[model samples]
Every structure is written in C-alpha cells, then in structure tokens.
Target: MAIEPLAIGVCSWSLQVKNVAELKVFLDRLGIDVVQIACGDPHHAAWDEGDAMPAAARAAGFRMSGAMLGFPGEDYTTPQTIERTGGFGDPATRAERTERFKWALSRTKELGLADLMLHAGFIPAVGAPERKAFLDTLAQVSDLALRAGVTVAFETGQESSTLLRRTLDDLKCPNLKINFDPANMLLYDNDDPIQAIELLAPDIRSVHVKDANRPSTKGVWGEEVPLGRGQTDTRRFIQTLKKAGYRGPLCIEREAGTQSERFHDIEYGVHFLRECLAG
Candidate 1:
C-alpha cells in the first residue's frame, strides 16, 4: 500500500467554534478541509446542536481525520491539577471515564473516522502503588477501542517518552497508538520533542503542529506561541517527521489564547507548516 502524503490541517476545537456551521466557516477561511474534530463532550468543545453534532459534521463537507475526547472535570489550570485529573490516572475516576470513552468510540464511528485522540494523563512511575490500576484502566479502554474498530491515539507529554513507550509495550494493544504533539513535551517540561520522535515514531498515528518554549520555572506550564516562533524548531520538526515515516495530517492546536487570537495563530501555523513541508 502507498502511504498518503502529509497534509496540513487544524483542530476543530482550536477555532473555538460553537457549531459545525461555525467550524465550516473557519475551515473555509483557512482553505483546508481536513480536521480532527471534538466529540462534543462538555469538557472539550461542546457543539450547539448537542447530540446532533455527528450528523451535522457528516454533512459539513470536510474530511475528518479523527475525533478527540476530553473527560469531564479535567482541570488544566496547572500542571499539578491536570496530572491529578487528566485521563485514567486517578483510580477514583476510572469507571466514569471509561464510560465516557465508550461514548466517544461510538461517536467516532458516527463521524466515519477510525482514530480517536486523547490525553492519557500523567502516567505513574514504574512500581508505584497506583501504577497497576492505571495500566489496568488503560488496557480496558484499549480493549473497548479494539472492539469498536477504532484506534485510540493517546496524546503525548503527560510523561516522558520513555515511560509512555514502556506503557505501550506493557499493554501491547495494537489499537493503542500515539498522537504526537511536539509542543506538549516542551509545555510539560518532559523531554525534547525531537528525540521523542525517534523513540515513539513507530506508533505515531497523527501529529499536532504547534510550537512552544520550555517553562522557565519548573512545575509551571510552557509558553505556546505561533508556529515557527518557539523553540520547537518547526523546520526540523517536519523534517524529522518525514524521516520517521509519519505521513499523517498535521493538525494545528492552539490552547493558550483567546478565540480570535487562536484563529490568528492557527492561520499563521498553516502557512508556517506549508513552508516547512515545502522545504
């Protein structure tokens, strides 16, 4: 089978749009038809049409690369808060979150997409008391995805590539892959995104084309900037992706700015990626 050439696109939620109509408007403005859409979970990006979002998106005349799900009650105010509340990390929230994942899998099928992306939260260190439970929750979710015929791509950066890689090896779930986000490694102060690509390349199913600078203060969030404006080295990032054989859509995600600002930055990101890919 021939691999598809890499295409540049954007995350639907990054536009901060409230409905499929609004998303279409922005997609047209950006002149791109490919997107990784939100699953209309209240915590992520809820749509005005509510349960009808899937139908609306189907008729919206764009290509959906995948669907994204953010569990309810996830707080991103600080690294600490997110570590505690993100994904299947906390044993207390496993049952509820697993149900949410099931719903997302159905929604993904409705969207006619095979990939679902999400943050798996901060992974517990090897041999930690809570580690077993965390891995067990992930395995359950992976099993659900396999049955749904959907590939779940966990977003990177909640932990080191080493740990994430080990977790994947431990689970050995074929459907459980990775959604590579370069800026995330910087934001979380976890690892060098470039080096991480080499380690996690084989399992990379999608890519997020954003840029960021490492946090000056430990335990704080990094600074997200327009593409090509941060320490991510946009040019090298693209080059590395190609070398690593990741030929997926580059979805621009801007989570640190206002609605208007995010739009502007994403627009810039599209052009920036064009140059990188072209070069």
Candidate 2:
C-alpha cells in the first residue's frame, strides 16, 4: 500500500506559550500548521471564557485537528496519584465530569471541530464494579459527543490496549475512538506502541508523536524524553502506523523541559519525524 503522509502537528499546550500569538510564532518557526487545540480545563482561564480554543487556532492560522479536554482535578504527579485522582473513572467526580464533557461537546460543535480527546482514567479490570461504573461514565460522554455530531478519541496509556479494546467493544459506541500515544504506553508500562497500533488500528483517530522511557519504578511516573531520544523506536513506530492504514496528524507533545529547551526539542523532533516519513 502507498504510505500516506501524516500531517505534522503538535498539541498546542506542549509549546507552553502564553497565548495564540506566541504559539503561532513558534509554530511558524517550526514549520508546523496542524494543532490539537486545548480546551475543557475548568481551571484554565482562557477555556473558562469559552470559544477560545478554536478562535485562537484560527487566528494563529492553524488547522485545528481536534480539541483535548482535561478534567479539573487530575493529578498526574505520579501513577498512584493519577489512579486515585485522574479521569472520569472515579464515581465521586463522574457526575461533574459528565457535565464538563457535555459542555465540551457543545463547544466542539460551536467551534466546528470534528472531535475532541480526553483521558478516561484507568479502566478497572473486567467484572469489577469500578469497571462497570467507568464504562457507564464513558457511555454517557459518548452519547453526548455523538449527539453533538463529533467523536471523542480517548487517550491511551493508563490501561492496557486489550482492556481498552474490550471496553470499547462492550460499549459499542461509534463516536468513541483512540488518540494513540506510543510514548504513553512505554511511560505507563501499558503496552508496546507498535503492538498497540496493530491491535487498535481501526480505532485510532489521532496520534501523539512524543517519546519516553519506562518508569524507573513500577507505579512511578516515567521520564519523557525528546522524540527519537527515548525507547519509542521511531522507525518501527511510524512504519507500523503506515502499515496499519492510520491517516491522522502525528501530534507532537512535549510535556517536559524548559520553554526554550522544549522548543528546541520540538524543532529537532519535527525534522526527525519528517526524515523518518520520507523513507
């Protein structure tokens, strides 16, 4: 099969800019036009004002690939902390999160976005009551997204691909999909990214082109390195993505490093990914 060229994009927040103008300056310098817009953080002042994500991306002359939402209180400081405080899996926060997701659905439509992405938290093991509840929460989110005529691509990494596949199958929601992050699998010790791309190919609607190492200690957070600098084999990773027929933006995400440091890494990463794609 002929390999499709993936759009070189980046998660807007990864640039850590103060505004869209700053982001545009950096994106222009980096030669990137696609952006996964950031939205739905109740804590974010710009998001709280609404319509900021799409407007900003448009003003910046970016192709808004999609929007990513984060719950108000997710603590990603450590694996254990996230298991307790991340995603919509927790019943204590599910109701509130559902409302937030519903708002996001409306905002997505208003912004004319095709879809949005979010972390659904750690899906409990099959047959666990926690699993059932988590599924229900996601189901509700799916309903809202579908009704709004958009997809919700759940981010990978907190759970195994097998379990994620099973959960999606169990729900049988058409609007739900995957934002495959290869680095996350290695970081979270969930599954190998190449293996996951094969397993979840049909459902992957977007991709994160970040790279990372496995956690130093199980249950601890892993170190996120610059692209091609970590264990995420870029050669096999992109090859598998092309072979699997995924046609989506390879959204670069750099969650670590200083502003200048991150910008420099992203610049190098864009070149590295393009070189890999060329071959």
Candidate 3:
C-alpha cells in the first residue's frame, strides 16, 4: 500500500506575522507552502482593503488551504459571555455581521480558495425557535458562498458535533462543511475529538493541529498546551482522520505561548504529524 504524503501547514494568525512576506520567511524555514489565514484582520495591512494580500502571498509561494473570518465582540472569557456576544448570535449585531460574512465570502472567492472557516456561536438546541433564526442567518451567508463557488466550513468544538451535523443536514447546503479542531473539543469540554471524527468525518473539509486539556471545572476555560503536550493523542488523531478518508492539510494552530515558543511548537508539530502520517 502507498502511504499518503504529509501536507502539514500553519495558520497565519498563529504566527502573529504582519503580512505574507513575514509569513513566507517563517514558512520557508518550516518547509511548507500552505497556510490558513484570518482573511480580514483590521490591523493587518495586507488584508486591510482588497485582494492585495492574497495575491502577494501567492507570489511569495504560499497557497491558502483555507481562510478564516472573525466578528467583532466575540468574548471567549466565559461560555456565557460568548453565548451572549459571539459570532452572529446577537440580534443587535446580526445585520452588521451578516454584511461582514458576505464580504468575507467575496474575498474567499477572489483568493481562489474553497474552505472558509468561522465561529457561528453556540448552537441552540434542536427545535428551539432560536435555532430557526440561526439556520436562516446561515442560509443567507451560505447562498452568497454558493454563488461565489466557495465552501463555508464551520470550525468545530464551539458546539457538539451532533448539533453541528444536524444543523448542516437540516440546512442541506452543498457549500457548508466542517473544519475539525480536536483541541477545541477538550477546550470546550464537548465530546471526544476522536469520536467527533467518526461522527463528522463526512463533512470534514480540513483539520487544525493543536492540543489542550479539558477544563477542570464547569464554566471555566481550558488550558491550551503545545501540540502533543496536552490531551490530544496526536498519532491516533491523525490515524482517525486518515481512516475517515480525509486527505487535506492538518494546519497547526498555536494561539498561546511566546512568539518564538509558538513557532517552535508549530515547527515540531509539522515533524510530529509527518511521523504520524508515515506510521
């Protein structure tokens, strides 16, 4: 049997770089060409106004496996806070966020990319009136992506895989998918990310390579540790994805630690994942 070659990458935001040129320097040292970028950061000049950043990143030999969108007022301090003010959840901010989502979709299309990931806030329970509104909001943005020929991938772990899967099934939107993040599972204290793979495999468009420990107490945030140093079983996780027939980039995402430390972790992650893939 022929083993699949590893396609490791890093999220641009994880590197804390200002632009694609800086990102290229690090990616070259890491020996990779793919990156998952937060497409429209207001502070980042490259993504300030137009398609310039994506174009330049490509010229510098980087291929975007995915793009990310983040809404203003997303508070991760507490679950309640985020539920009250995260993603497109708040009615007061829905209109503005909706417009942002549309614009982000346009950029995703212009970058010639397919997978766009974002937080959709905590999903309400099935049959809840609020669920309808959430689905309706998602449909509107998904329609824009469909027209733009882009796949809108929701990053996993904010909600249970079951809820997300049910939502996608009900929506039945072809352009909707999932970017599985196992660390998020532990961070959110949701279902096991390994089992999540079994459940959400069909919809997994991409995956994030990170690690975190489960929250020790309810209503508290979990701790994020370096890749393979937390709760995730790195080897088994990659095996699960491979078993599920997912053959996409496993992007490194280190949102904690100092800049140099984070870079070291991501560099180690690339080699670690490569070993897992080979094993």
Query: Which candidate wins on lDDT?
Result: 1
Best by TM-score: 1
Model 3 residue 70 CA deviation (Å) reads 0.8
- Displacement of the residue 30 alpha carbon in candidate 3, Å: 0.9
lDDT of each: 0.91, 0.83, 0.82
Clash totals in order: 0, 0, 0
Task: Return the clash pairs for model 3, or none.
Answer: none
How would you encode candidate 2's per-residue C-alpha lDDT over 176-261 as one tens digit per residue?
99999988898888888888787799999999999999987887778899998899998789988999998888889998888889
Error of 2 at 237 (Å): 0.2
For candidate 3, give the lDDT of residue 84. Answer: 91
lDDT of 3 by residue, 226-263 (tens): 87788888889989888889988889999888889889
